[model samples]
Target: MKEIESSNLFPDRLYLIYRVGRLAFSSGIFFLFLSLSSISKLPVAPSSLFILGIYVIVSVALLLFSKKPYTFEFLLDEAVIFTLVASNVLNYNFFSIFLIFPVFFSTIILGSISGTTSLIFGLFLHIIFFLQKHNEGIATGVQTVLNSTALIAMFVAGLKLERKLKSQAFYIKELEKEKERTEFYKRLYEISANMAHEIKNPLASIKGALELIKEGKQNERLLEIIFKETDRLDRIVKDFLHLSRPSSPIKTEIFLPEAFQEILQSLQHFGKNYKLDVEPIKFKTDARGFYSTIENIVRNAFQWADSKVEIHCHKNNHTLEIIVEDDGPGIPEEEREKIFEPFYSKNPNGSGLGLSIVNKFILENKGTVKVEKSKLGGARFVVRLPLSEEV
Candidate 1:
């Protein structure tokens, strides 16, 4: 992201250039009128007076034009060119110094390249003044050079400082965004967990009654299907409750690979009938939070995987990376961001809270989860957890 400069001097930085330009032109007009009035008392040339009048008219017109919302490019180029022309016409040697104001102002408002261009244009105008015989020999040259050089130096320094400020601003923005995401997931987890806890008893009662009905001499296949569905719903409600409630406060230092081993063992016991392939590698993370987060992800992977599932973990500096990939149908890009939202499941049978819960767990543990195309030709979940040292 590009950083924008914020200074209290201007209400809006983009509009500031024009504001400064208008002020400069108006001030130039007042001084030009004073000079012309004073010259009138002396034996100045008629040509000089005529030139001053023309300068005033053109400067006023430029001031009015500057009031409009012209592009920054046009404003800088036109303002500098016109100011230079006006200075030459009015035989104003001090106008070059006044031009420096806008150049410095433009650099602060626009950026380095623009400020430098304006400064160079001002230098070219000074050269024009020198050639026109408007200003004298070595003294005028030296003064003009010194003023232009100072303006250029100020602009360069401002550019460097502005860049530094912008970087800090961008970093702050990123931090804020991460904070908001964390808060959102935190609240969502709390609310869903509470609702799930409230409904758990009722779901359990229904599941028990359904099982009793299946145990009785009801139609065997129909009863079995109903019982199975009730069981799925019961598991969904339990998952919701688990996500809603806070885990035990106790934390342990568990190696990442051992955590995955436990998750694989649990998945095997839970999904013995379903085909699953578990691959493991070295991992380092917080034991309890990492276990919960991985369990949620692995469960989701199992649900989405057709008959194949792959879990891979890698290590980077200060982060343990895990990729849960499946061979089932992948999610579309448009729905990727929303899938992590609570109650946004794609499967008809899903409660839509699994990924939401996963997101909450990851965030609480200072990690992030994102969806992408899996190497297995299905949905891939990329998780990044801070290393133990960072924690």
Candidate 2:
């Protein structure tokens, strides 16, 4: 909408440059005519110089005023055009030919209404000038009519062309936006499909377990299974809800090694064998997002590790890199990328939301994560984050 208004309201840079170039060309032609008139000793009216001087002044004024609001600058240009046409016509009747500039400019810049006004003004001035001269009546009238008609015709043609170009540009912009929207919906559909598939299996299991418990004696084992499945579903729903919510990081200062030490202390209660090799590093960023991301990654590592998990953290220049590896069955090369996708998991008992949640938080915090083969002969997850200058 703004584009449409701008185009109709003002002459673009190309048109401005074109007008300046036209002025230069006209200057050259005027100088050439002056030289010829001097050589031939023709009695050229001194008023011609005054008219040319006035034109140059108006052109310069328009250039200076071009930066003004579109409507104001346009009206100013039209006024200058009128002044030039009136002065030139009155001084030298034949010079009304210069009316072409404003006529065409109005058409391209201000659209049809102004174009029509310019056509009428040009015709009116030229007719009045011809009457004042009162010589070669029919020829002058014929010339005036022809010139006016040609100027109007050019105005009409320019208006049509400008409208067509603007329409095409607007259409192209809309199509590009539609294409992006379509791609977004396509991704959404894929995520929805995965969610349904993941939720269906657990729901069916819970239904069967509940039926067993009701039909037979309420076995504690079956009740336990139901509770476990319910918890799994709850986690799935919680993570899904979290992912759906828009994320905005609340940044704060945090020390990397201190944060890692706290995470390790919390996990020590699980009695899992783990190793930590972290360098002392400090940075300012979203502390909650950082903690949530690292916790998910390390928890997944512990869940899959055979006996031990190795954790490593280091800072290289302005970046902090953390690696977690498990001494268990490593991820297959083909499944590495899929592991980070929502609702994608090889473990039958897994909710498959862990890595996706980690990835989401990291991305929101402007950090990155990737998976590879670890030195421990198992899967390795590496996360890199930009360190703030306050570090």
Candidate 3:
């Protein structure tokens, strides 16, 4: 689980591995009984292969998924593993009581309550099937009693281990959070300086425009300069807010056609200079962030295209792929890396925050965007976002 700590001795990975071992150990017992029944006095129950089949299926399910085990799953494991022990007790094979030790080591790896529950379930099976035989042999009775005592002992021991593991996990998780906070603040500090520089130039342009208007009179050309500079400042501030805020995108099921249509309809005022070749994909992502990404990238395409722009979208593996290309001049290889930097633009009137905003939003959504030479001999912007499996 996401809450499971990385540095703990009882890490989730180890628990998963233990489960696999649990499956293997239980399966091996069944295999032994079935395979050796022909050559030896070894007893094979009719349910041995059935139980093994269940172990395999459940083990496969547990390993394929990334989730914590349920209490009932451990109970099932108890049923399968202790089946042989109960069988052995009924057959007067006291040597097989040694199998009870393996239960302690594995169950102790879990929380005390689960371990206790498992032991109770296992002992219940032992009583129902083999407790009557305990009266027939002193050794059977002694080992059965020891099984109960070991349940209490290991349960107390498991509680302490579980507490120690949990506290360590909590401490490590906190350290990870603190480290992320430190890195975030460091980036914030760097961007604050960039924001100030971007802010200064626009303020100076507005001031100069106001001074000229004050000296003579308000004219269209001078007024336009003020408005343009004001718009630049606004764009910079909005983009800065987008970049500076923490990126914790909440994903939701998104219908791709609906999302794309929202942006396409808004940009219809620009003309039919666009062609969309999109797969009718339905997936999950941060819907708001996805719309922003589509709007910004397509708007940038329109700003650059001379005659036509094309948009293509599809799914690749677990990722959603989006490509926006235009017939405008493509970006030179050297300038491509700087394309997404804040306040960097080739067009004189551009705020230069469009691609930067696009990049920020994509990254926040656990996606990537890149520029490449389009097949149409122009710049192509490619965006990829991971698909949520729930969809």
Query: Can you write out model 2's per-residue Cα lDDT over 81-154, one digit (the tens) per residue?
Result: 44444544223333434556666666666667777777677667666756765585676677677766776777
Candidates 1 and 3 compared: the better one by TM-score is 3
Q: 1-391, model 3: which lDDT tens digit per residue? A: 3443446446466667767776676666656766777687656556666767677777777767737656676666666556654544234344234334334544545566666676676567656645567567677677666666665566566667667777887887887888878978986776677678778888998899899888987799888988988988898777667656665457677778778778888887766488888888877666666676789899888878887899999989888899999988989999988989876788766667778878888877778888999888889999988877436
lDDT of 1: 0.65
Worst 10 residues of 1 by lDDT: 1-10
Number of the candidate with higher TM-score, 2 or 3: 3
TM-score of 1: 0.47
| lDDT scores in order | 0.65, 0.72, 0.72
lDDT of 1 by residue, 264-331 (tens): 88887445233333334444344555666778788888877877887777777767677888888989
Cα miss at 149, model 2 (Å)? 21
The TM-scores of all predictions, comma-separated, are 0.47, 0.54, 0.60
Q: For residue 311, what is the lDDT in candidate 3?
A: 93
Task: State, as a TM-score between 0 and 1, how close model 3 is to the true structure.
Answer: 0.60
Worst 10 residues of 2 by lDDT: 68-77
